[model samples]
Target: MNNQHKPLQNGLHVVVVGAGIGGLACAIACRRANPPLPVTVVERAPEILTIGAGIHIPPNACRVVSSLGLLDKLKQAGGYQVKGFTLRRYQNGNVLVEKPMGMRMKTEYGAEWLAIHRGDYQGVLLEAAREAGADILTNAEVIGIAEGIGESFGKHMVVLKDGKSLVADVVVGADGLWSGVRELVLGRSFPPVETGDLAYRGTFTREHLKSFKNERIDQLMEAENVQVWLGPGRHAVFYPLRNKTEYNLVLLVGDDLPEGVRTSQGSLEEMAANFEGWDPILNTIISCLKSALKWKLLHFKELDQWTKGVIALLGDASHPTLPYQGQGAAMAVEDGAILALLLSRLQNQGISDVPDQRNQQLSDLLLLYQDLRKRRTEVNVAGAVDTRHYYHLSDGDEQICRDKELASLPDSAWQGPCSFNWGDAEYQKSLLGFDGLADAERTFDEWSRKKSRQANI
Candidate 1:
């Protein structure tokens, strides 16, 4: 298995479990490869439906979306181009930091920042995957995975709850946070850890906001920007969607929810109580919320490995993170893109006649995928954790220092003692301007050369 050799089309079949953002992106990326690989995505739900409320797709992810030719579709689906973010004081609604994102993002990162409804984003990816020749099987709940099975020498078996099974050359566990495939890969369950925080999320249309009859609320409904208010043990984020026709809001608060109770019907009174004494604008937004669902915020522990034999995990299955930095979906999108690049490279290295060699080649490729993705994903996970602390700081000298640093504005290029930097453009670029596909290709080349030298020695 070398870069110089091209793998013959031995009819490799890839089965991806789960049809969320990560799973759908993986299927699309694989099928769109130069010499496209056969892909089938199995989703447990009776029908594909969006579970979350909204998602912020920063430039890092926007680049991938553009490369896949779905940016236009995303925009057409009511994706709002975010101008920038405004961080305001919780008590007074005074601006602390104004980080411009629209033109600045494109000029520096080569892609626009987009705020979109989660369902619309998923629909775009699903449509693209199907158009790229990937088969999608709905209501096909994968109950378990069995490796080293099948008469045609299949490497893995995906057992379904419906008593049907699918055998494939590779099994992708994109099933998300409570992934059964991940448990199978690790030989035990490692549930995500609770972060002592819960979020109430909802979306509101412009017409709905107009009912409030408040001028400030009306302005927010018309503006194309993301707004954040930080308070002790709490924070709120709201942004427009679908050409400013709608707005999405997320309210995070310290909670005492019992273990294993993740989702419940959230009460407006409870949500408002958490923001007591806060700016009136946030209250208005809260008033406009027609409905909301509250869920505990949980994070996954870094895994020792993301792949076992011929099975691999992606997205939330591998590294589920808090939404503090808004990079959870971005990381998953990058994972799928890079994984596809590596697999496509493997396809170019013609298959071996010996079964052992073929298996070893596939294993090596999986290892490379893990090696390329592990460090970045871990950094993002840690960054999100750091953001959680910074965003929830109580009133004190530390909070004062954070506000001072933020007050320095877009002109100051300095890093303070705070855990997160809200105004630094360079820091933002490091996270937002990353090119995952390019990085993967570069790393693969380096890895191949190193192995080549070792073989000669």
Candidate 2:
């Protein structure tokens, strides 16, 4: 066993389970912190496979990615800069709301919204993490985690499926919704609940779409915009990718797929059946979709604690939510950025004279990370649930009200007495303009001063 009393800059090791987006981002951030900490990321998959479809990189998330010097690489990997989003009625494809996303979002939030393939995004983060000095080990699945001995020794043992054990000063669980580390931290199993939502995702090249010979489809293919068709109990979002060479489409509906099954082969006929009476343009897109993967959406109840001792959780492992708001990955990225900031602050404090003080400092740092992230993530999780309900409102007075609010877009131009505004100024400010690293630093500064004053007393 490694000596527990070694200084953080010298011997502190961060073992991150799961080499997904959150885990890779955490590894990169930790290694890039001042004094440069050692980080090792383990993945259960034998090899890194390009999993999932497209992802929306909102302005808030883009800022973090850019800070990591990955914006150019991300773009090179066929990431499309989202210019705007058009919300339309699922019945006839009538535009209800149009919101600008490119220069407008950049001018307002200091970052541009990007839409990219999930594989490209993860690859960028993974590569950047590797370059930042994080050791990545694939096919190393963790089975159990046990607390280290002594209060002053902030160490934990991570046991892998291969019967190998690794000890680290801290352990981070970013293993997605079905996180084994979460079960260990909580001392019981906490399975994710099916949200009764299923999504059919697919990506097709422009050449394949051109064979359809539909003018509406051709026009849609040419347009550089993220389009969403909303209706009762369902919605579909489509966007272009790879400099308009390919497009990604996602359809979400209420379903009763078996629990624990992430995805299955879905036929185009079944996908079309879900939106039987929707717009003809939608039908055109659906018909062109070759083979789609339908996955059951799952949600985790807001965890009461994301950290216990030196072990902590990040991303879906800590707070998994519906995709209604399109902030799941963004929230996970924010968690990684904030966690890095907190851990860096501890490194800045230098090794304490007393071993007990050093241990307390490490514990306090993890607590601060939880404090800075938990409330924001909880609120966002609830917001995702609320958005899901709002987007799928049945044809009623509430739906009518929602349509009116959506119609009043360009929020600045609307002078009517609408109680709700889609993408309103307040919402934009809170969601787009949030700087997680800055927020974490401010909170940590306040906390450190408070602790110093208490110590003097």
Candidate 3:
């Protein structure tokens, strides 16, 4: 669909304040809309850099990736399919629970789950967005936003830090956790609440595994399984990336970083100390790591609203989901997929040329987006919190019960209730099987009709 579609509709210009995965996805989605809207992404950095370790393109997010015609591209870029998941005891490498996801995720949830490096994931989206004709401007920092000023009601002013301004019909706040756009929308500074956890994250090449000459590590990599090592007050996640040629590891522990320091070079000795007497395989993997970076995890309380006038928030700006569930990036991608659907359909809403009516319609669309999105994101946040609690369980009856529940999960993916919502069919159906674009198209029409009836009343 790149460069082959008709020229953009040119009715409304969209300015996206961030060029991260969520923002770039938004740009691609808007460009793909029928009679597509024009999008210009304003990025603060001098250049877009590939950062982070691995990200999961779960079943729900796979819907969006497939829609953008990038599924094959993702696979080509080292997004390997995850075959299964294992929860192991940290004291010794004993598997407590195991579940299958490879073919089963596609069979049950309509799409396969992908574990890809963050760089590869963002690279594909960024390329497609540019090919789809999204104007991307880096080193452009947004400083302020003004709307309904200077004899113009159709345009909003996005004031950049360098005394330049861009005009747009809508401004998207896809800026990340430390989002300046978020503060702008709320008219006050809001900070992310610390989760009191810091992730010691590392990624290693396939050669590193081979250098170990350890059969256990080699077999694990070949299996392409997602493994979690559970211990008291801590947990570590390990998954294959880059077509199973690379490995990503994240160890979550109580934060000990200096105040106000969000990230630092992690000490390997300290990292080893945190996992004393743990699984030798885990320890061996740790020793293989060349370096580790410590990142403090933080989140935001749910907001009452996601939009202020023509400005709307998406991704981390509004949600700031914790990484416990691996849903943070997926939710952001969903936000872009759904929000673009509504905005692209804006031209078809059949509003008169009256500026007030048009503005109100835009506001209504954003509000409806907020209503549809709020509950779902809140549910995800709770799910992550639940998993975190269970994953970091101290040795006790509850922990034993949790392990038992995980071990006894049914043969079918969507089956009877389990203590683990992540694996429970009923719970996961609502999470993994959701189709955001379809929901937006269906809900927006119904919303518009209800609004029309109310206005007549």
Error of 3 at 401 (Å): 1.1
Cα RMSD (Å) between model 2 and the true structure? 2.8
In candidate 1, position 20 carries an lDDT of: 90
Q: What is the TM-score of each candidate against the true structure?
A: 0.94, 0.93, 0.95
Off by over 4 Å in 1: 1-10, 148-150, 413-419
Model 2 poorest ten-residue lDDT run: 413-422
Error of 3 at 209 (Å): 1.4
- Encode model 3's per-residue lDDT on 300-330: one tens digit a residue: 7998778988789999999987687778889
What TM-score does prediction 2 earn? 0.93
Strongest candidate by TM-score: 3
- lDDT of prediction 1: 0.82
- For model 3, where is the 10-residue window of minimal lDDT? 1-10
Q: Ranking by TM-score, best first?
A: 3, 1, 2
Query: 41-123, model 2: which lDDT tens digit per residue?
Result: 88999998866778988889999988877889999998877877888898999998887777877888888899888988898
